[model samples]
Target: MVSGTGPETVPEAEFRSYYGHPVIKRPIWHVPHMPLYLYLGGLSGASSLTAVLAGLTGRHRLARAARITAALGASTGSAFLIAELGRPARFLNMLRVFKPTSPMSVGSWILAAQGGLSAAAAVSDVTGILPAVGDAAALATVVTGPLTATYTAVLVADTAVPAWHAGYRELPFLFAGSALASAGAAGMLATPRAEAGPARAVALLGAAVETAAATLLEQRLGLVGEPYRQGRAGLLLRVARALTAGGGLLTLLAGRSRVATAASGLALTAGALCTRFGVLEAGRASAADPKYTVVPQRERVETAGPASVPGR
Candidate 1:
């Protein structure tokens, strides 16, 4: 019999990267600008949708408020984006070509289109010069608005960032819901409580969707999702959830009191902004950490076995 040492246990491998550097480069997008653009883009998109719905339902006051909000959000968001790019021409340059495969290209086009449409709608509403043209512009936004709101999710997810790529499925839903909540809040704040019933309903629905999507994203991502639960990202997200949930509940009671409507609107707006910031922070954290990148690649290699790995 061979003198035998029973099979020895293998030591678990510790994650490391070349010189402790991150495997992937961190995002170049700046703070406040990127997150704020995200919030405003979503707000513009959802507000446009809300405006159309309100107009169709004959809620002129609510529709007018939403239209103005959408225009302002788009214009302001574009300015932030331009600032991030460091030149006004860079913003215009993006519109020079449209690439179907590129999220950035598509998003740029959508932003431009949405901005123009919303602005026209707002101007027409305010000036009362061309009702037909304004109505057409507002109707046009229904197509571009949702695209504007959700395209940023696609943009980030297309990157190699583990947390963002992993949560791709949920990100759109989260963004969409946040957008709706933002627009609803804006509508409620700008319009009287009596005319804000639809806005309240939209806010509640949006809050529910946002909360559910965020929960599912954290639960489904396993290790990749850790960034969202740890550090600054985690803190912001937690606050976002609390404020959004609280604001949603308050929206239920807003019908009876103007104070309640204002409170709910403000809370939901703040919550939506927090969510955008939290998501951006999570992406940065995940990209900065080598473990998030290495572990997932290692897991895939192990699952495929040494024989199946490339160059084996």
Candidate 2:
């Protein structure tokens, strides 16, 4: 409505005045649901890592837990996502069509595949059904697991939220690493160190990824990524970095026994949770500020120069 060929048409002195709040629409969902999604995603990823390790080491029990966890995590996460959508039945529209540009579409399919595979793998013990199916499911888990761990970053980034979208590359890698670490940690506690060696390796890898990804995220964002680097997000990120570092160290010393592995696992899990929640909060904060959005747009306009007005 305020479009003009020249800046003077709106009166250069009459700067745009923002209303009381920044957003045009309020987020309908509650906090628990979003964070629940974060939890489910982490759980699913962790379970996948567990499954892979278990299969590799012939630790069926750990593998069982991994399969069950992945299934449950995917189930719970899907429910939360549907609930967050405001209408459960409308969720089907997500699958009615596909769009690679739409992170939700990609994520939904990823989740569906992960859930199906996880359940199939778990049902091997429950129904005494098919061992072949179980093995197939286990194989599927190895592929879908990383997507489960990482696609969430894309989902969050697809939003209009500047903070998340800007950190896209780093966030996905970070989440994937964290997921592997958390699951491996859980396995270490549940199984012997000899069997849980993969878990330790996962934890160490996750810690390294988390640290590097976080650093890259901050460095790459510059001013646009300021929301994540300051205030509550900043605090959470610092904690995550510390946890990852400490956990990686613990993982390296995992041969010391189950206790060390357990500690590393816990640290990695904490780091994963922190990263997810922190990113969410940072997005909200970025959206809440007019300056963050306005300044950038203004600079762009100034750089582009005044536009030509048809009637002027």
Candidate 3:
């Protein structure tokens, strides 16, 4: 209706959404409990693997320590998971049916099997009630251990969470490395210095792998990686990388003294915990921001060309 303008033409907008609402539903998982569960689950899985390796190498004391660590971690982690579920009774229903397509279902079954195996191995080691049975249980963990360590990554990444789903390819590696480092740290802490060589090696290797995977994930993700570099998540990730890198370096020098070894192991464990918390926090942040969801979908649509119809 302007006198100078022939017509009041509205400019076409490139993208549209409903009132800044999130396109994807956010995960309802609570903090501390969920992150703590992830940390313990990784610890349990990695310790199980450490136990198997120790047993094979005739490092009986280390094997015993690993069994104890696995059992304690799984048992404690299950408690956190149940707390997250908001009811202990619901946890029992997880075993009613096995759904391979559902990560939660698969993880439940895996955790159940792991709990039984780790508990048996730990008990036999403690009471000498059934040494043969304990050895068999420990051996069985060789199958479940890797799954236990890596499946949480699958569980988290197989979601609508932008940061988690986008980084699915590298998440497993990150988680597995964290698990191995945790197991190694626990083994080193519990075992005598003379027998902690394998643990030290595992810790260093895991730290290196974890650091590399995290760097690649951040670099390759571009805009999706923003959440990881902003706010509390960024601080946590930065701390995690620093601790992991420093811990790995310190572990190399740990051969000189027991105090140095203990310090390195503690640092590695703390770093792994921080990594878990950071990843979870990043996902939460990504889901909270409408820009993360809307912009990505918009890019995909634009890249798909004229023939690409919406809502396909």
Candidate 4:
């Protein structure tokens, strides 16, 4: 309200949806190529957990490498995301006001803490390379690994995107599972046969979670889930399912041979990437259609509308 300006007068009334176009604002470039960050961060965190498990079980070399790589990846991926945000400085605004309802805010804090802990843990391992710091880093990862593996689904679910918003109940489970699988993959590659037991467990659990989530997402979404079941989204889903399954199977046999471990690691990594990309694509497609938007709103209105009177 400017003091010199005349009383603010309302203009002609118009009823229009925001960004009325069903399509999103950007071209294919807007596509989330870096959705790998989510995958990487989760994988990194899970790998750290695997490292911890391996360490507890007396797998020193495997645990050290896993912890180091996981922390590095988490740190790198987090940096990429912060750089990508429109207002990186506003990132701190995330902490200014806490809102569990906002996944972005929650994820920001999670990532921040994860980065510090992962770095500390990974760096601490350099006792051979930097003995003093290695000790402290290992201890810090104990707190960060689990949060890193789990918070990404919350980030996706907090959005207004139809696909993500509706699938809130299952996305965290899906992401966590995927993270576990990914971590297992890396562990299989880096760990000795005797030490990779926990990696196998994580992979199996991850595959189970991913498969269950995919089944539920496809079944429960009705029409809105179409994006995931068709087109590029469909392709991505297929690859994710296949890779996750293959990876899990490979993990089971990881103790037998190095080839299986390598295959499992690669497959799990591929599956994680496919899942992340597919999710982003599905959200884009869901937002791109007027029918999906209009029909749902109309259905809601009709169901809630006032009843008509026969006489009136």
- Report the candidate with higher TM-score, 1 versus 2: 1
lDDT of 2 by residue, 18-134 (tens): 667664232344676886786687678668767867787777777776777778888888888888887777677888778888888887788888888888888885667898888
| Off by more than 4 A, model 4 | 1-20, 23-29, 86-101, 128-143, 304-312
lDDT of 1: 0.94
Q: Give the alpha carbon lDDT tens digit for every residue of 1-312 in model 1.
A: 233766667788877678988899999999989999999999999999999989988899999999999999999999999999999999888889999999999999999999999999999999998999999999999999999999999999999999999999999999999999999999999988777777887888899999999999999999999999999999999999999999999998665788988898999999999999999999999999899998898899999886756785
Q: What TM-score fits each model? A: 0.94, 0.84, 0.92, 0.82
Which lDDT tens digits does candidate 3 get at residues 125-223? Answer: 989999999999988988887888889999999998999989999999999999988899898889988877777777888898899889988998888
Give lDDT per model, in order. 0.94, 0.75, 0.89, 0.76
Question: What is the lDDT, from 0 to 100, of the residue 132 in candidate 2?
Answer: 83
* Candidate 3 least-lDDT 10 residues: 13-22
Instruction: Please state the error at residue 215 of candidate 4 in Å.
Output: 1.4
lDDT (0-100) at residue 118 of candidate 3? 96
Q: Which one wins on TM-score?
A: 1
- Count clashes in each candidate, considering only residues at least 3 apart in sequence or on different chains: 0, 0, 0, 4
- The candidate, 2 or 3, that scores higher on lDDT is 3
Collision count of model 4: 4
Compared with the true structure, what per-residue lDDT tens digits does model 4 show for residues 26-110? 2232345358777888888788777778777787877877887787778777766766665567677777877777767777777
Candidate 4 lDDT for residue 63: 80
Top of the candidates by lDDT: 1
Q: Deviation in angstroms for 300 in model 3? A: 1.5
Ranking by lDDT: 1, 3, 4, 2
